[model samples]
Target: MAEEVKLFGIWGSPFSRKVEIALKMKGVEYEYIEEELGNMSPLLLKYNPIHKKVPVLVHNGKPIAESVIIIEYIDETWKHNPILPQDPYERAVARFWAKFIDEKCLPALWNSTWSKGKDREAAIEEASQHLNTLENELKDKKFFGGEEIGLVDIVASFVGFWFGALQEVSGLELLTEEKVPKLCKWSYEFVNHSVIKENLPSRDKLVAYLSARFADASK
Candidate 1:
């Protein structure tokens, strides 16, 4: 019998989409269960008792939390259409970029969207610096892991999807073709990939959701 796989996710969450993309890339068959952020399911709580976040990958009754960790798990378990490189040095480099984006770039990007006044300005500056670093890093390659999409590509996929929506909602334009040409080109290429193109969140819904979120935060 084939191993049973199930994914608990939220529609608009880029973190959730990362796991979904990894699953699709690996040709893993799984059931998708959409969870409401406000009222999470009991199974989700049972699976990820610590974080209780969505994008939990349950394989044969075992639960894996954290999007990157889940992606690594999927890659290690399935091993078919590998997301990470086999070479140790290359894999380490990919993990470094992935971790950097997850820790530094993502927080700066989020602050740029949600913060106001001086805080927002600082956030934009920080985010721009991170983008600049990425631009310099991508000066010689099509993807972070060279010509093919890999772990770093998956972790940074949100730059193509959520970053634009956040920019629209926040009324900021940090990523432009002229500003970060290479990064912008990579984003377009990443988003146009079959898996990403098909699975992106609806623009209208995201706009409304983010608008409400900002409004609520302001109050």
Candidate 2:
């Protein structure tokens, strides 16, 4: 019997795109099922009942939720192209950065875009600090994973792509070339990566979507 792989995800979501990029990197063949947050599918609900979110990867008869976890699973299962590091310590570091990106950097940056008044100011400060931390981390390295696109690079894909688009829509200037040159350079490299570039959604479409969403949220 052949292995059956299916992914349920939203097209415009960075989280969903992350998993898709990982799958492409590992040369995994799978089915893509688009989902909407407003009208989430029953199968998606069953696969990820707790989160009720998209980017759910179903393998054979089992289901896995969470983009980071699913990417790790993809790396582990298909031993061809490794996304994480080989050494134990390096692997730990990769996981650490990935966690930091998801938990710290993304939330702060996102809040800075969506928030208002003092809250927005505070969020911008917090987000800038995190972005600086990432800048320092990428100071001398070609990629966060060093020389190649690895776990951290994959995980930080939003900072490289979506956040920039969001920045345009929100007009919040946190991730600038002067403020974080290393990160800006890294972003250029990350999105232009052949596999990653192919997997990304249309920038014009993404920007238009964010513009309308932000306008609606403001009103």
Candidate 3:
């Protein structure tokens, strides 16, 4: 068995938190090596030389980069809880949404935070629209991929955990119950799930960190 699993990541990063929650959900015991963002450890750079990003999953001797990829790898390797769906079509749908979150939804989230005046207003609208789509998709399901939190849930985790803090930091409200009611409920549920709750960073600390970072970025 490839028993040795080590994760290189920072606590505040949504990407890192996603991978950490995946491992925790799978009941996989692994070493958590917290990395300092600016002064990254050599192990991180050596393993993920191209991107030099955190949340790199090192299993046995091999390394996997990217949050979604690492999550998929963990699902395949662990084989217990089954994060991704077994059906091909269902799995494809899951992957599609996951990718959409990373490429489209997350960018809209950043734009909402990073831009100014009219641009910020536009970004909030764009993000709110995306949340509406996700809201309808979530509908009656407890999670994005159904009753149990699965691949898509992990991918959309940022909206659940981080974005609330981001909204507070930027003074932008895009995920209110009135805006995307289903998704708003889904976000609260996702973040408070037993496995997810324990794995999250402190809300106050996260907000303070984000507030400072956003303030710095705006300068």
On lDDT, the leading prediction is 2
What global local distance difference test value does model 2 have?
0.94
Off by over 4 Å in 1: none
RMSD of each: 1.2, 0.7, 1.2
Instruction: Quote model 3's TM-score.
Output: 0.96
Error of 2 at 180 (Å): 0.6
Q: Which residue pairs in candidate 1 collide?
A: none
lDDT digits (tens) for residues 40-132 of candidate 2: 998899999998997899999799999999999999999988999999999999999999999999999999999999999999999999999
Candidate whose TM-score is highest = 2
Overall lDDT per candidate, in order of appearance = 0.89, 0.94, 0.91
Error of 1 at 190 (Å): 0.5
Ranking of all predicted structures according to lDDT, beginning with the best and ending with the worst: 2, 3, 1
The lowest-lDDT stretch of 10 consecutive residues in candidate 2 is 36-45
Cα lDDT of model 1 by residue, 57-124, tens digit? 89999888999999999999887888999999988988899999999999999999888899999999
State TM-scores per candidate: 0.96, 0.99, 0.96
Question: Which regions of candidate 3 are displaced past 4 Å?
Answer: none
Which residue pairs clash within candidate 2? none
